[model samples]
Target: MEDRKVIIETGWNLDNSYANLPKLFFSKQVPTPVDSPKLIILNDHLAAYLGLNVQSLQKSDGVAVLAGNQIPKGALPIAQAYAGHQFGHFTMLGDGRALLLGEQITPRGDRVDIQLKGSGRTPYSRGGDGKAALGPMLREYIISEAMYALGIPTTRSLAVVTTGESVFREAELPGAVLTRVAASHLRVGTFQYAAEWGTVEELRALADYALKRHFLDGDGTENRYLFLLQEVIKRQAALIAKWQQVGFIHGVMNTDNVTISGETIDYGPCAFMDTYDPATVFSSIDMKGRYAYGNQPYIAGWNLVRFAETLLPLIDDNKEKAAQLAESAIGEFMQLYHSNWLSGMRTKLGIFNEEAEDKILIENLLSIMHKYGADYTNTFRALTFDDFTDMALFDTESFAEWHEKWQERLGRQEESKDSYHELMKSSNPEIIPRNHRVEEALEAAEKKGDYSVMEKLLDVLSNPYAHSNEQAGYVALPEKSTCPYRTFCGT
Candidate 1:
């Protein structure tokens, strides 16, 4: 892990900012080199964002570095240390199969983490081999890109490389590596780790670093940790609101996966809800529905409270006063969350101006959707582009009553009918990463080595707002199943 042992020519505009932190924050870990690495996909658009050349990256030496077979010049790779409340239980955790290779200073002067997932094992691997199967790695690439295209704040996938190796899981699966770009790898669990394991000085150092990286616009005169807490609360509120509007289920909202930078991080066991049910749970491990679609906002609030607990010592020297400040700051979470959710719902429903009855109207529509087992995305698309009466789900007597009320509401808008429908079209996507389609794409690539299917999906997903005939196939309702559709962590 020496900066001197430069093995590849990578003009990444690299700066090892996270690596410069106290050694306790991370352990120097070299990627376990893979055999016969081959580049499967490269996000050229994102490569341009990182100020990198996809042509160079598609070469053999670049593929070697990309597959963890070589380290790039100016890169100081490390496995970050942290702890998290996993499914409501506290545990120490850190990077097991991931390694941060340093930050890429983009053309826009933005610094983003360039990390390799499914790279290899590190001190945090515990008792398992830190290898990743091709299917899951490709899954992250697909869904993460789809999220980015949907205008959600999320980590972007740079590339995926097949390692010509196998990881033994449910069955022997082909191994792969994913290069993930993000605001930073810092998470709520990271602060928890600092509070629990590091000294006060170390925790302060971490907070100062985070402030410099993220909250650069803040004033120095105020309590920076308090400002940090306030910013995180606002971001999480807005983020989860967006998720709910789109019917996305994180499936596991672990403290470790809650990012401090506010970008959606982990895609493990994540899926979008087709049926508009708040009680939807898709993660196979979530038997009790702890992180169901409806529970995300609350779970996020719970995670923020844990984050607030970590900052108590840093918020003030007097412990009681610190607790009060943290409590006051965390208390604003629910209100902020509701306000954000309502605002997003308004846009989706084409409510140009809010009225006292708007929230009730939105709730009533959702109630009807849930009652009739209506398709969530299509319902909005129908309202945006077609009359609700044309859709059979809205053909009921109750729907007609609700439709009349909705028309009355729309009549009160200051904006023209065309303008408001335009707003709705932008807010509501024509396509989402539907579960059945995603599974089919993954199966084609993993089983038959046909990546064209995934590529086509990504192509259509790259523009979720646009109306296109090609996307019609992707927008079709999934075939009904006898049981629930489930996703796994795959580790």
Candidate 2:
């Protein structure tokens, strides 16, 4: 009550470009007002990037806006409509509990989506309550920020707040909202909506808008839709490769979660692997491991096929020719993914020059890690520090053999060992959001209302490449009690 006295800044330079789309693409909605909103955290750096004054946003009015209680001036909030294949099953889905609060135009003229996750109900809420528990919302805040700090393209968390109320899940839990920033909420599922629900005119408009918004450098070819599909395929391919390089398993690669902008979205049920197992699956719903660590690239390519299918009419007038073109475009995913993955592996291994056997060498090391159950992040990070203390964990004969071959390959590069090690160190992070550590942070926040653990964890993760005695604890793999950890969708 006392906090509400602070005047809210009404200087947001917001644009409603997305709301101008065909009415079928989205539904006009406002976030349900929360009771007694309170600030949890604010990202001053990200706030400045979006041209917001941090001092103004720190006031009570800012908390009100962030909590969806007050819409900023010039803001046009709406929930987008789309569909997705959930765990290999077709389903209609949309922004059930999220609202896009207009686009913010940064000083650089870049447009970013300002969205409120856990805002409230929408037309797509289905039969469920539209709310998010505090723990999972904070989990998304932590993990998404970590991913951005790792230099991977991803939607970012700008601020988080508590509704000062409870949301019902498995049990009663505190309610919170996460302010998510993204290139745009445009997903492969958006195109699917145009294809399956809207008219061809809508589909073409979406394609043209996406080209100008995301791929403006396009050569203006006769078949611009086809070019859009190829660009999405390439982006997804490269994005997945980066995920693999960093040991990230999205846990759910549904068509809706696949962004046309190629940044990682939907942090639900996501986890970074502790051990180097290719078959690792942490999402409780992924019983068959369809979105396992090793299967991400293939799953991305599969999603791309669905995206390409949506553009068939615009790709060509002849159905058969469109199918052929789609096939060729989808076929490029594997080679592109492999090239990106191998290139990243080469950098991780400190290989400055490409070699025919580089792929094999990298795979051999991974095989050894898999056989020995070596910790993925630690293993690569140890190499950067020239610390092989855990080398004994591997099969002595096998590791020595791989090391001999790898050394021979590295010797061929003109770069000095010091420079190569620096490159490797920068490429491979010394810290990841370890499952056990994340759980501990969440438990503290939910049970005791202590956020220091999560805050300290984020501080260390911010400098993932900087190794110090202080960060050694964050780098170690958790004990077996934390193994077989399962993440929830937190719906």
lDDT of 2 by residue, 362-460 (tens): 999999999888888888887776678855554478888988898898899899999899899889998899988999999999999999999999889
Task: Give the poorly placed runs of model 1, Cα more than 4 Å off.
Answer: 1-10, 389-391
Encode model 1's per-residue lDDT on 324-361: one tens digit a residue. 99999999999999999999999998887879888899
Best by lDDT: 1
In candidate 2, how many Å is residue 241 off? Answer: 0.4
| Weakest 10 consecutive residues of candidate 1 by summed lDDT | 2-11
CA lDDT of each candidate? 0.91, 0.89
Model 2 pairs in collision: none
**Model 2: runs farther than 4 Å from truth?**
1-11
